[model samples]
Target: MPTALDRPTERPADARGRVAELRAVRAQAVAGPSARATEAQHAKGKLTARERIELLVDPGSFHEVEQLRRHRATGFGLEAKRPYTDGVITGWGMVEGRTVFVYAHDFRIFGALRKAYGGAYIVMESQSIGADLTYAWPTNETAVMGAEGAANVTFRRQIANAEDPEAARAHMVKEYKSELMHPYYAAERGLVDDVIDPAGTREVLIKSLAMLRTKHADLPPRKHGNQPQ
Candidate 1:
């Protein structure tokens, strides 16, 4: 999907051209760089984000959204290498005849049964955040940000003052991930409810959704809550 993002920003001249553009981007987003890469995922016993979504929603029911969005982080030689969907495939579809939205960020999330968390991790609905139930795979990591970013923010002085800054940074990043970012770490502390196998995701979701199907939340009756700050 133009990881370098070289596509023309200009809109197509006609509806047909626009439709063609849409199809082209969808193909690129779904198929990725090539078929071989998809096969590599299978070889490693993993499913791509798209495939994982397909595993949950009813057949032919899933519809993707924002398949053309790209990361805006620049200046790591990455500005020219940012791919569309930004490694995330977000959308909605019918799950057991119920409308469900999904925000799949590569190997990280599947809403109620997924992984990881950032500042706005509520977008993926953690149990302590908004979800009724949460499940995670065994290989997930959790932190407000990647370990590198978190370490830099949390251990700024230690890293800067170390005898060997690079080694200190690396060791700290590793420690942060293992200690504070393990998947079960969140579950143990009640941030996450449980950890489930990926293969059983559909069943767990089906049961959980059924239980929460009639659950409803109502805002407290109040006036003038949006007072001047």
Candidate 2:
């Protein structure tokens, strides 16, 4: 009797062949125009997903896993469309010799739509292998900034209609209260481990990596799905 890692005695070769065929179909589907288009878009941005990962990790130390997985969609009308890594790039690598798993949104393709298979695989793998740290930088800050600016404009207009200029002053106070208060709140809640100057990002990451190396041994294993249980 063969083990699961080998060939199971119960399963037929036809079934295994079908599995291999489906994997091949998935790879072929996503390896076409969509993948090329996505790469071109990233090139235009002067930032490939892989380059971003390289910058974030230690030079010559990062090792990537699962670089070839692609989207598997069989939905109506979408069956013909290949989603190109489901619009997200995921893999594990070393940051200053510390192991970590990362997933970055590919804003150039499908706006980071979740592919059922690839998405689930990354999520499950990350959970099982675990990572010392996770980092997420929003790729769509332009939209967020626009919405915030619009809200500020609306508040200013409303303030101008007030009977007292003091009321208008209060609007300014409220605006800062909402916007500027968050960073301090994040620090207090420990949501942001640290906030460092942009120029010091490399130094900060190095220090963080050092700290994690020593600290990781003391910390318990990370739970799957990031749940405590």
**Listing every candidate in turn, what is its Cα RMSD in Å to the true structure after a full C-alpha superposition?**
5.0, 11.1
TM-score of 1: 0.73
Residue lDDT tens for model 1, 20-134:
9778777776776567766776788878888889999989899888888777777757666566676778899988999999867664221233446585555566654457787
Regions of model 2 farther than 4 Å from truth: 1-46, 59-61, 73-80, 112-190, 195-201, 216-229
The true-versus-predicted C-alpha distance at residue 67 of model 1, in Å, is: 2.3
Give one digit per residue, the lDDT tens place, for model 2 in 1-229: 1112233334446978778755764564334334666578666754555556677766766554444444566676554544445555677776766776666555555544322132352353333245444222222111112323444565666656778756675666666546543434333444334445544555666776787665635656756765542
lDDT of each: 0.75, 0.50
C-alpha lDDT (0 to 100) for residue 217 of candidate 1: 95
Candidate 1: stretches off by over 4 Å: 1-18, 71-73, 107-123, 144-175, 221-229
Residue 157 local lDDT, model 2? 69
Cα lDDT for residue 155, candidate 1: 94
| TM-score versus the correct structure, for each prediction | 0.73, 0.45
Judged by lDDT against the true structure, how good is candidate 1?
Answer: 0.75
